[model samples]
Target: MRNNRPMSFPRQQARTRRFTIGVPRAFQISPDGRRVAFLRGRDGEDAAACLWIRDVDSGAEHVVADPRTVGAGEEDLPAEERARRERLRETGAGIVSYTVDDAFARAVFTLSGRLYAVDLDGGAAPWEVPAAVAPVVDPAISPRGTAAAYVSGGALHVVGLDGGGDRVLAEPEGPGTSWGLAEFIAAEEMSRFRGLWWAPDGSAVLAARVDDAPVARWTIADPASPEAAAQTVAYPAAGTPNAEVRLAVLDLDGDGVAEPRWIDWDREALPYLARAGWTGPAAGGPAGGAGSGARQDVVFTAQSRDQRTLRLFRADPRTCEVREVLAETDGTWVEIMPGVPAFTASGDLVWIGRGGDREGARRVLLVGGREAGPPEGAYLRGVADVDGERVLYSASPAGCPGDVELWLFDAHRGTSTPVRVPPPSPGGDAADGTGEDAGGVLSGRMRGGTLIVQRRDMDTDGVRTVVLRAADGGEPDGGTAAAAGGIESLAQVPDLPRPRVRFWSAGERGIPAALVLPSWYDADSGVRLPVLMDPYGGPHAQRVMRSRSAYLTSQWFADQGFAVLIADGRGTPGISVEWEQAVRGDLAEPVLEDQVAALHDAGKRFGFLDPDRVAVRGWSFGGYLAALAVLRRPEVFHAAVAGAPVTDWHLYDTHYTERYLGTPQQHADDYTRSSALESWGTVNRPLMLIHGLADDNVVFAHTQRLSSALLAAGRSHTVLPLSGITHMASEETTAENLLLLQVEFLHRSLGGAAGVQEAPKGAGGV
Candidate 1:
């Protein structure tokens, strides 16, 4: 029953949010293993997400809560909620995220600033917690399931499930202070989304208090609407002071009253709050058993401003005493992997440690006075879940740099082995040449003996999720359950044409890359094609992966009569640690050199790329690389479309920029060399600068300054300013038309139907 219809790729891509609208995400498996809760939009074109639950036994699905039922429209988001979503890069609406109690009996979420709680076992409709304030954000039910806590109007509040005894737990003391919320840097750069964690006993909560008074303010205005007042934002640029963040434990009694006890830590030495959470009593301890009154352990991860040192601290919530458990140091910056510094039920501290006989490989280390890691060559990615004595994690297997697989490490058994998660069925409608079976990416959660695994590969169109009994054959007890069942995804099928991708490594550095050819391309014709080098060649972000959907845009560009090349040179993740850290202290040289090397090697092997007519296009970090290509190496790249590019490293944020280039005062030469602004005077190729005027992240000043410098140098360039777009082009029309405009520009500049034009002789003419 496939509905094949005619549709514009650009319009469909924009309307579907890059085909992510209907995907089921944020999966949570109940400890009892009875139900799995997730969020999904109504369909591919629907932007409003609804909460859904699947029965593990019968595989029956039910819609627990829908925004439409509550009469809340998608456009009524609070200012704080909007800002949070922006930082998360989330484009969906309606129950975008929700939190469940430890027992998974109840769930809490916010829609249009109204907090709603649902009883999972009772199957009752969600009821609003009558808040004195209208808008609330980040609501979470207490572990005890009797109360819910949320942030509203710069204050943290707790209310009972019966909608009674509503009281404020903490409030801001100054104009720029807020309780129970993550600051801009923490949310945007550090990847620590939540600002509060509830103790396992539900007797208390640990919350973050952020004070932004010391940060500098920047005004963002809409020039098209001159009469409107400009929006002011507290921005911490590189080398600027970040918001002061302090953690406090809030003791919540049965009556919904709370007393705050501030945790003592050296903010001057470790200013970056990487993570915080509570762990139960150590294994075999007096209070380790259920119903024990022994205080739960509070753990946190902190990093120095330079990011070279990261420390794990254990704090006493009662007396606020902090003690260091472990510390890791690196010559370059240390990466903060997600789901680490976690404690096993047996009291062992689980973490990712670097260099254990593998030279530069990151390995999962279990330490409880003693340290142990997985077999050599297993590059640990992140910790997924820690049940009793087993830790489920994702890692790149030995000799498979492009594949990520799930492995279970049992500290009690002292064995680490791959989990037998099912892979996608072979012989489907995979992207042209990529249908060959490669390892699928594994991600999921484990509770008790039940595991919820989501599998995706380059050959699959969408993700497949399954609930299964553990490998040890332990079945969860509770709820009309029989055996494990697969969760059916209601996501709409993308009707676009399938992409034809070829994955390979190029150059001596083994730079990973993917090449896409047009659907109508005929290799027998022996016609050389124009080359479009599309890359996000920077740290943390990878352009080349085993996922097929990751190349949809590149495939579309290829269909427009050009060969598309996406290279993941040094500085990208999912590779060895050495490759990721190769760009330290010098961002431009190695990255640009790797891109050029990939292009030449790819062209030499394929013999279909016309190097003389090459153009590059990218956004953000990729945009910076695109501009750098033409400005510094004009002879290699003839044209480029740079979108929201960071021309100067100084204009970027503190954590991300400083991690690579260090402080501007100390590494001034590195900043100058890494900045695209420094080489703008040498621009000798056709370049178009695209930027959103309202973007506060990279700011329009980057484009403005670059254009000014280009003009002063008597160089010709095109600048396109988007009036109201941010770092992301969320506007449907803008996102859709941008693709078409880029296609048209590339066609004209690279000798397509629009006719080719050569630059002036001194401008590095092709």
Candidate 2:
């Protein structure tokens, strides 16, 4: 219930800056809703993100050991020594952070390359699991919470909560080890990093093994020693032969050790393991009759290379046998499955697939029948329901942003009645012209004949707990009476405000954008605020309107009254692959033109936009775009911040860098034309460049090369080289300090009312 009046209020004087930036990142709530884990980060040249766990009921808290604190305790490291250590560590840092999201289990864990478990009760110290295991990441805990499974050294491993037995399940075969199963690479490329799954009885584990030995390897040099030599990196680009994938199950039969048995997925199948998980009991068969008198089921989806043809298999862990239950192929590439398929406790499979002949238009399907001919494109948007009797999904028919209707269909009954459910409007944009909305049951469970749905919104910004009757009739359980009103507006700003994302049209096609408004907004006053625009500008990618990220300080600056915009310019995902490849050849031209147009369009439509006070910022490839925007369209933005930006694509890796922009040798002119280094002479704005000396992603040379040219051109700018932070800095202390600098720089140039003093900085700011 919001005020409907559109009245305006008078201008007010500035107050103390009491705004929170960042989001409740890696947000996790224990299965029973008794505990939570999240990361609090800082803005600086090198970001420092720290982990914290809290009791959901009592609000008690404890700080997980920070990886940045490894080896050196607080106050122990002088600048130079710390830098040296950080550089060496960056070369191969394992899991420096772990987030727990165990809905089926109560106890949760956290690790900074080290395992530790915490009790769900009040204040408790995290018990460290003493082991130097290859950084256990992506812990997939069993529904019973007795054991957790994860990937290490390209093999699957499982650890118990009671301590003791911790052993590898799928060890690499013979001489040729897993091509590259290390951190960073696995987490970035393959969707699943710590790949491990639990059988229904929790007696076995299923995992994905990536054999990337056949891939081409290229070595990159340390930015500090660019001309010294090169270090090798095994990378496989699109169309190139990918790592052979295999599936195996670890039978942990009470002996506290995992027995590996490979499951036949047919290598010639050439299928990408898009989604896989242990199916629940029911659905009948041997899978439902594993050890411990418990029923166990396994399900996995494999999509072929061209992204067409999806094969779904149901496995019985007892016999290590896989039964191909469903398969679908399309003339055009079949739409990517809408995330992993949901398995009901009754063993009913639910998922979202496409057939409407257009992107963004998909249908909800309950995979009951075997023959799949263009899945039931009837019901629209959806979220996978792991255990729902009917296929429940979220849908809004082209004009509503967050007004999602929860539809339930009983394929058995052939009925498609939608259960009326209310959704928060992430933004009040009508669902017309490519505008997108997000909603779903955060996590729900059937307790005492009642269904509890935890609902949250990207629009209104908060989590609401609601209970519904099991029969969908009568008053909800506990006489709650449907919560007075289903929707409850939570705090947009907690200790750290969730990133505030909004959707607005910037260019032609009225494209959608995941924009963030400033934290300290004066909706009543009609004063245009400065803007910080970030455009991802890549393929199959999007900056969706969602909560803030741990690595971003967009809200912090917004807290200082500057609007931050992250628009998914034309070439980005969320639209179509056709739209994605449109700007492939054009390169920087399309992104730069669209964003600049957006600035003016935003200013004209929203009077609160200070068009002249806008600043552009990005990192990596995004940094390349940011540099281009300020250099090419200096009039659109007043300042620019590019961190570890790709000044020249020729120096980047072969896979992603060359995909859209051919080879540097083939398209020499395009490379030169699109590169920021070539246009450094035209960068007239107040540009601030930041890069980690040990960065291997875009490499420090990108900045080093550009800085030299800037100096030769006598263009004044600020350059800061972080000692050891890589492309993406995860340390909270460092990130916070970097954000503090961003705020100071933005405030100084944009003339915004500021509060906090500048954070301390180390050497190297030219």
Candidate 3:
């Protein structure tokens, strides 16, 4: 019986969107580093975020705009906006994103598809631009703060802030074409969400025109509401054709009728436009400070359809001529690093590459075509931000996969130093890459000379955001500290018991693993607990992080009378590139091997773990792994719960699926060897499949096909279909019941007693 519990941890977690609503995020710092702009909700439970600015020295914050006060009272999101938010995993309601002008005079954002601009100086209320089309998207304020450019009805338009001079700069010429909008592949896989970028001087805009005529369309229909029309989406599945993307320059000073000068490139060889922007002397400088229109150069990166070759090019916007700046090719497909193709103040190219060759050369920071820093063995994640001559990056120190730390590279000083987090006690060094604070995660942004460091550690509950100045620490010139001043968070404190987690490296490979036992579990009780292996054993993500928040859900599961084990295995990131690439051409074996290896090693290490009653549960790639665990290695995992899993990789998208398996047309064996559908007939365990009927990312068909295959084999299983829900089960009722139902199923399948615990005292209900 799935009876609801008042003030339950699951309900509160869902209501507060995992306690992320009131956290200060989407930050932008002014040139002087004295003021910072951010987005946050008014209170812990407030869903709509309000725009705020913090006075660095005074430590005072004031709301610049509240969506409830300024908006149309309801959000009528466009399909494009909804899809963009889905891809971004943005759960907040109001002012999700905003762009500031070069001078930091005003900021532009879109609400309910209408455009709104507010002065950052706090003297005026935000006013909606009446000239814009009803449904505008991704409005960017010009560098000179004169006008804003936005996309509407598949066309690019510019509206003057002063004169209200609205004009259509570029329009779609065909049915499947759109201007200033990212293609599905770019947004879902490449992380390049926006298709238009402003030139440094704001006189011109570089926009992408996408034509999806060649792509195949898939239907997403509401089975429950058959009267609803089926929505068709362009899905470039593995081996299918992708949308054609091209770049063009649109001058804001023109009459809005002339044809845009298209950037020249060999599209046949490199069909994927990875990134695009303008680089100039005015980059990150004052409004229209130095670089002008004609002299500015547009830069972009492109990749081959197979994704093995990546090229960066510099283009002359005037002549539409392009020159290749650099090229990197790999036999196993190149990984796309974030915040790249950037530049230093001295006109040096700041890029992340394999240093030299794909073999042996580690992923390192490259400055002006040279291997810059991070020593040799550290795993360089990406260039966080480049301020003048200083480059901030995130990385996992050598031999420490669970710890993610930040390091700064000073081009002027030829030195690379770790950005330290202050010790918990006084008179100690900042959080360590491997020292006492070895289990922390750090992500921050740097602008001008100011740095914003957001940290989540095992010692803390949620995130702690600190603002540091040039003199306090993180000043590009010199000085570094744990933190200077902190931005307060209104996020709700978790109502669950503190997780009793122990971290360690498992096996000879030293896979990062964590064990979360119930707070009530006693070693001397003589009651051996069943083991639950939880893992996201895939690429580009890690499970065994040092953050306390990362394992809250896992801890909740552990409290249900089981020892939850989490692992970051071979295919997961934050480890070595070789470890991540181990699954190439065979995504099933290496990952599963690591998971099983970690489980057995953990079972042997922990005396009270009952290995015979082991179970596995996961979602997305983790879901795939959980089901794979039972189907392929039933002796190790007796029961499984897979939610929204990719049962057959052949149904997955191009950019992500093709990276490891290539085209299914070329490597059919890899798909068969990797997908859970290949081993469906071998199932001999209690298996449950859960999926959302309306999920676009991992569509419902994935579960349907696997269920059909299992039925064909006469294997018994359970399928729970969530109607009218997407990939994210954020609804309070659904999310809470999902937990309750999963725990009930595990107890019944494993023949264990129900172990639901009440909320801790003083923790109010949702």
TM-score of each: 0.92, 0.64, 0.94
After superposition, candidate 1 runs with Cα above 4 Å error: 1-5, 254-259, 281-293, 357-361, 367-374, 423-437, 475-483, 680-683, 753-766
lDDT, model 3: 0.81
Considering lDDT, which of the candidate structures 2 and 3 is the better prediction for this target? Answer: 3
Q: Over the stretch 1-766, how does candidate 2's per-residue lDDT look in tens digits?
A: 1222221110000000111222233444443434455554332111244455555333455555344543223323332222223333321121233433234223343334445554434345446554437454445556566666665554566677677667666667843343113222334433433345566556666666666677656555555555665655555543345556667777776553456577777656634666656655311111211122345566777766544477878777668788887777754444444434665445555554544555554444544442122224222434523223444444443433223344444444555544432332344211112112354324333312233344445544334444344234432222222221221221223333445556676666566554566444555666666788866665545554333332134555555566777666667654443556567655788777777777667766677777778887777767778878777777677788887888867766543555466666566777777788775434478888998865655678788888888888888788988865666554545665676676677677677632222211110111
**Candidate 3 clashing pairs, residues 3+ apart or interchain:** 7-765, 421-430, 421-431
lDDT (C-alpha) at residue 471 in model 1: 33
Sort by TM-score, top down from the best: 3, 1, 2
Q: List the residue pairs that clash in candidate 1.
A: none
Provide the clash count, candidate 1.
0
Q: Where does candidate 1 have its weakest 10-residue lDDT segment?
A: 283-292
lDDT tens digits by residue: candidate 3, 494-564: 77778889988999889899999876677787888898888988998898888889888887788778899
**Candidate 1 structure quality by residue, lDDT tens digits, 1-766:** 1223436777767877887777789887777666888898777766788889888756688788888886465558888998898899998888898888777888888888888888876458889878778688887778768887789888998888875667888888879999888898988998888887777777777888999999999999989889989989999999888999888999876454466788868889889998887766221111111212455767888899999999988888888888998898888888988777776665667777765554644655564544455557767788887776667778877656667777777666676666654433342211111112457677878775677767667766766666766433463221211225456555545554567788888989888888888766776667788889999999878777676677788877777777899998888887778888889888898999999999999889888678898999999989999999999999899999999999988888889988999999999999998988785435488889999988988999998888998888888889999998889898899998899888888877776821123211111111
lDDT of 2: 0.52
